[model samples]
Target: MREHPRDPRAAVIEERIASRPQGSWFTDPDPLKAEGDVRAVIDAARAQGAMPVLVTYAVHHRDCSGHSTGDLTAYHDWIEGFARGI
Candidate 1:
């Protein structure tokens, strides 16, 4: 049987990626829940000595293929809640 060799650089790259600050995506349909979740993420990031980066992807007709699609009015409300979280 042949032994498989692993690239030592892969571990270093993975560690670097894990050490970096990551952004959180808010895709919940419920505005209230999204608000609370965003706030929690922000708080957690702050506690970790990192700034929060958020991604809002709940807009109506997102991607134009029915993926993450929602009503415009609801999207507006969701954005409002997301803002409140910040």
Candidate 2:
């Protein structure tokens, strides 16, 4: 992990649902729809010499969706990494 510092080039992205932490069931595979799209996002970033600090999140629950304090906390860190990398 890299140390945090202020920079305009940085970016942060996050998704959260409010009981479980992020990626409680994060599969290794990317979402089907996201597969191609994410590559494109990465390609665009690379084309411009931008750093890609990628992180994915998933919340585990009885159903397909749920969240907890841990999820939000994870979201914060993921976004921070993304932003710092940028």
Candidate 3:
């Protein structure tokens, strides 16, 4: 991991694995699974007497430039779905 500074996923997985003693960990690989993932996290946090914070991701067309990007309508839809999830 020291040799892969730009690999955020690897860093997150490594941290999760190392923090096993602190709590159980879960990962959602599907980018389209945000709604369900957010709900799951919120439920888990509530169960532990914690408040959850959700940060949304890409809404428009992505992958063209190796980043999350989207147009106004797509982004608006994403935001709406996120709101529904909450």
Candidate 4:
């Protein structure tokens, strides 16, 4: 576990598990689809009297394989566009 400077009382835990025989698949989000897609979900939830939560996952060096990755500046710009679309 490791602690972050921004949250002194909070700790982050990371663990690796053994691989299973069954295979797994992964899909990445399309930034182009994010605006309308996210807004549609948020609108639906609002109509149902539910609050929506947004989580930002794009970060520099994410996945360590150049997949689903974005730099900080790009992240901020994308988020701005997403908010505008909402």
Top candidate on TM-score is 1
Give per-residue CA lDDT, model 1, range 1-86, as digits (tens).
Answer: 02423766777777898888777888887889888999999899889898888998777787857666667898889889998988
Q: How far does residue 32 in candidate 3 sit from its true spot (Å)? A: 6.3
CA shift of 50, model 1, Å: 1.1
Summarize candidate 2's per-residue lDDT along 2-83 as a digit string, tens digits: 3444543333422223222422122232244334444555676689796554455432232434433245555455444433
Please name the candidate that would achieve the greatest lDDT relative to the true structure: 1
Off by over 4 Å in 4: 1-31, 61-69
Of 2 and 4, which scores higher on lDDT? 4
Clashes of 2: 4
For residue 69, give model 1's deviation from the true position in Å. Answer: 3.3
| Candidate 3 segments whose C-alpha is farther than 4 A from its true place | 1-32, 59-67
Per-model C-alpha lDDT, please?
0.82, 0.42, 0.58, 0.53
- Each prediction's number of clashing residue pairs: 0, 4, 1, 0
Task: Tell how far residue 16 is off in model 2, in angstroms.
Answer: 25
Models, CA RMSD each: 5.1, 15.2, 9.0, 14.4
lDDT (C-alpha) at residue 10 in model 1: 72
Q: How accurate is candidate 4 locally (lDDT)?
A: 0.53
